[model samples]
Target: MEDRKDSELKTFCSRNILIILGFSSIMAVIALIAVGLTQNKPLPENVKYGIVLDAGSSHTSLYIYKWPAEKENDTGVVHQIEECKVKGPGISQYAQKLNDIGTYLTECMERARQVIPESKHEETPVYLGATAGMRLLSIENEQLADRVLTMVTESLSRYHFDFQGARIISGQEEGAYGWITINYLLGKFTQKLTWLYLKPNGGDVQETYGALDLGGASTQITFVPQDKHIESPNNALHFRLYGKDYSVYTHSFLCYGKDQALRQKLAKDIQAFSAYYYVMNFLNFTSEEPPSQEKMIDTMEKFCSRPWEQMKIYFGDVKEKYLREYCFSGAYILSLLLSGYHFTADSWKNIHFMGKIQGSNVGWTLGYMLNLTNMIPAEEPLSKPLSHSTYVFLMVLFSLILVTAVIIGLFIFHKPSYFWKDMV
Candidate 1:
């Protein structure tokens, strides 16, 4: 009787063990499917389309991005269907004289709509962002913005494209969003990049990045850090503005742009660089008995005639550096910023140069993504290549976790007398 009972007990245990293993296997497969769904290429698989409108102080314009059926995820970045940043009086500056601005926006939309191929037209979602020039408008001039908005909306209504909300974003927001747009476009080839998410946004670590965005109306300086690395709302580091201590460490300094700056006396012969510091340095000739601020203001009243001969006494030995850095036009400023910036001879090679740009779309988009994705790595000791160091650590940790999970799963299946085995 004892042997029979023992045999029966063993058989029962074996059967239960098989049942548990089967269930566990099914659950593992389900978990894998979920992970795959989440981790698979983040880019959309369906036919993709989008429209980006940059409503500026001088002009409102549109850009159309699309992709064919086979090349779904590759839309918007490589191919820009239509890009029209027309030249017009910023509605706010002109105030009551905004009717032409409204009509101009309509024309841009109409031109964009006509250009985007009809096939990809139906499903595109249009997103618009207005900057420096638009944000500074007085309440009285705000009606011109409304008129432009109305004109743009009316023209775009011809197609299935829906109107996205437009915003006159602060400099910090503008800087962040600029980064986001760059990352999204660059995310296509980012997998090939083995370094810091150049656009590491807000997490628990509070990313300490320097954002310098120069736009047509104003410029911004944004510095945000992430507290930690988590995908929850609480994982963000705070945003700080440099100009206003309690506020975001970002500023939208009014009338400091290349165009606006040149029209003032402080502008002097400062037509070379697009940044305030550089421009200020160029215009402030030490030997010429630095002109009064009021005199500088008077100089700007003429709009566009530069007086350079007066600087002969002021430019000592540093004239070459100033000329080199400042000589580029708005379009050429990007390269200068990316070139070897001088920090110290040793560090200058890698110093992330803050080259002056004429716009903020790049910085603003990036800032937005960093905050939105919560990818900021921890604040490790600042090594020479700190970002690279953090990136390597993250990749190693992810690989180890993945490998361990796979090994443990195999062992559980291979061992029959494991923890989940049934007992009778």
Candidate 2:
């Protein structure tokens, strides 16, 4: 009887150990499943930011861009987050009053600080690019232009963000960067990955749109033409984008911008008006008081002021008559596009105007950032993530298999002892 009781007690203890092992295994599996689910949850993105200030002839604009930190080397990853238009005229206009130019940027700098996160201020790069207006200013008055740039640079340096050098960009750079900006925003440089290691349908030939940017002081035309015989050596630009070589024809018509062209038209109109007024004895003018470009534009503005008000009421301020005083300006644009550049009317359909694309403004700033950041890699990246549903399914299937194996091993190890107990 004592031996039988001892065997019964031993069997009871083995049964309890088996129960505890089974409970612990179930709990372990549950804990693992919970941990796996938690680990799989998507984390917040590690984002980097940049700022570019477009100091155009007519106005100044600030653009804030952001991209994922890990995807900086990926094409089409950069995106515009916010854009702030600085009040008042372009910095070039402040040639005589250089001190005020710095003051003009105060509001914009404050706004940028508010828009970008505080932590990114140190790393974020701020660039100031003076466009055609400053280019012309530099040509006409080098010292004054230098003063303007220096003042703006000094002001920008006061801000918390990293200040890159401020300088006047050439017309060629403007055209090329504008092209890059449009193509990148259109996702022309990026390719989608496939499972079979084969390119997607229609992926062999990349379809890219030409960029036509019309600013206040200059206009740019850049396009990849099949005809390699470039009309002008200065207009040809070769670039390797996303491992694809592109031979493009680009041209920037200086002093052909709306504002400058308006000034040009006013100069001609004022010459005629001055002659007529002197002949009529309506106005007095001397050799010392020569009619300047500024005087000409002001005269034209006064002459068209009444007509502009009427034109505004009739056509919402975008009528041909509103620009009738500067009709020569419109004719100049047409002549430049058709005759000067030899852009065929048939090819006009491919030209996309640079104003805004998908809510973001299309400009050289976007391209400028991409180049500085080294975002466009030569070789294509092969890494791609699996689908969300597939990943979850695989994890759950793995967990279930692991649990089954553990339970089977426990059963096998205890089988000898249980069998021995029963036999005894």
Candidate 3:
């Protein structure tokens, strides 16, 4: 009689355990549904946190923006960006030493964490984008890129930080997004400068506008002439780089970036000089007559054993269009020429110094930063040039968490041992 009772008790305990497991599973499913539904819960009137990270071939950069007041009509955005740090061997190539690359990224993020105020960073949405050097590598190289990305992401995870978004996009996407940022700023400058430059009497300014952006491995020429008030997306800015089938308005060239010249061959012969020489050339201009081709060529041969400085000398007029010197480098100057316009050094209006790079002086005079989202039509939402956008990333995050929870619950319902296995 005692043995039978003990066996009955054991059976009762297992049955009770199964019943409890079944109930817990129902609760878990309901919980996941709650998390997913929260996505469409409608964001508050204003988002308090925002961040952006641009990891390029030569450097890594971060920008943080916050909406100060939460009113729908109260569009007040306060933001700060940490200084960019040098991180060579971008994503594409950095994969070789995956661990080292991750460290480079960590250093950048940690530095930002220090600079950003302690109060606001807890929930900042950090967006990171890696380009060129990382995008162009082979499959194995890309895997290395992924491995490093995962590491840096996990490292950032410790701080309750979320990747607002991160992706590896294409050159075209980059060009477009940059143009969007710049062109949005252009709105602030339009009527102000264009009005000022408007040839007094009549008969148009007899000229068009263009931009030259020289990055690590590529140079772009963007131009759009305004014959009559400039049309769609017009504040009259264009991007000539990374567009397909170009029999057209702008021009651009690849493998022509200043940094790239250091690795591969270049037409001009500054082979021996450091990258800063080019920087110095742009920044340090004096009343001193420009160097002679012969002298410049001699300098090159003596330096790179080629007629390097001479080319710069020969192209003196166009190269000089870059007024700020170092800010706009060689690639920018090259694109300046590709504008294929009759631009003397005089044509450079010093856009960087111009009150508003775009739009109305209202944005500039008011001393406010305009988000690309605000100034441009929110439609067609221009995005980073990659398959993974912020929406995509979040969708993935939600999907993963949901899938994982479901798997756990399913295992538990069918076999209680799964609970321990999942935990382990």
Candidate 4:
């Protein structure tokens, strides 16, 4: 009778302990789920929009950019949301027919209106920056340039956006901005603390890639030189970005763009083909793995030496005008890069001919907008103490550990006989 009574007591205690442990485990799991659900909720995005119209020599392009309002000062935060190419020629071309400029910009403005929310339209700042074409026009006729800008500003003001005024940007500004755009997109400006030792001399500064921009009316080369002393003060631009000071060397050559260069070459040399990009593309010249100078010359000579009538038969789809200037255009590009820019064969490998970077067109327009709006802060923004994921993970891990500890403590207190049995 005593043995049976003891057995019943043991069974009762074991059952009660199991019930408590099960209940505690379920409660812990419930708490963990609640914590995860509460902590991991997504926050609403507060976004801002801006518009930039890049009025180039050959054409005009409208870019709509958007970013998180809180991250406006962060590098690579601004991105192109929409790109609209104006159907007509560049605004500079409408200098004589100034009245038509409004109509020309209407379609793009309407598109911008459709893309952005109606509530944000009034707050969105619109900017127009005319490049080399306008610069040349301004040089030849300052009054005409002024009139063109006035007409452009008036046209843009008709929209609901906050018009920031339109003006011709200097070549130096163009070069510097292009460099900024490239380096910014490349994420060279912001360096993490972990990467400090990787840099030469164990310095915190990051190496920046040089920018080579080729446009319709001009070409710009900008980079931070190895030597601290710059010979030409006019070509040097100093910038303080993300808590780092940069002294950059930049130069923009007017009429050195493929189109203008082709015209100059055609006037002086024999013109057999007219298309600049089309011809080079046909020869596969515009690629990351470009041919050596000797090979490029050889290829061009062979292609240009082909009989004109046979060429017409083979490539009849191409325009006669563009078909005749291939050789001269090719030679001019090589000479301009090699001789004019002084890029030797050894340094030439580093040059990357990119039309776009990270889905945005590589140009001075993005950089121009960044400067005007003060998007790039002079100092680095403070980072958060803990990321949401890391916080969540730590909370879950600690909760698990606490639950395990409680379970072990309960097991030891209730089932001390098991431990004694194991030891024996």
TM-score, per-candidate, Cα-based: 0.44, 0.70, 0.46, 0.72
The residue pairs that clash in candidate 2, if any, are none
Q: Estimate, for each residue in 1-424, the C-alpha lDDT of model 2 and write its tens digit.
A: 9989987976786677666667766776776667676666676556778888988887788889886665522433677888887887778878988778767988878988998889889988899988888999998989889989999999999988989889998887788887887777666765442222223244454756677665667778777776656888888877655445667788887886665766732321121001112211211112333344344445544544555557556556443533453434434544565676676646544432234556666788887777666642333333324466766776777677567757754764658466555656
Q: Relative to the true structure, how large is the alpha-carbon lDDT of every model?
A: 0.45, 0.66, 0.45, 0.72
Instruction: Show where candidate 2 strays beyond 4 Å.
Output: 1-19, 71-76, 193-207, 229-233, 264-310, 316-332, 342-345, 348-354, 375-420
What are the runs in model 3 whose C-alpha is more than 4 Å off? 1-49, 66-81, 84-89, 138-142, 180-209, 223-252, 264-424
Q: What does the lDDT read for residue 180 in candidate 4?
A: 79
lDDT score at residue 67, model 3, on the 0-100 scale: 43
Error of 2 at 101 (Å): 3.3
Q: Which candidate is the best by TM-score?
A: 4
Better of 2 and 3 by lDDT: 2
Residue-level lDDT tens digits of model 1 in 1-424: 9988866876576566556655665655665555445444355433445566665544455665543333212222223445565555443444555445445566666776687656656655565666666666633366666665555555556556655555565555665454334433333222322332343333233223344555555655443334333343332234322111112233455665554544422222331112533444444422224444344334433212334443333444556434433433222232323341122334323223222222322334333423322322222222332355555565565555555655655654576356335422
- Alpha-carbon runs more than 4 Å astray in model 4: 1-39, 72-76, 191-203, 264-282, 316-321, 373-424
TM-score of 2: 0.70
Best by lDDT: 4
Point out the higher-scoring one by TM-score: 2 or 4: 4
lDDT of 3 by residue, 146-231 (tens): 77677657655666565644567555445444433344333322232243323223233223334444556655545444544344
lDDT for position 411 in model 3: 60
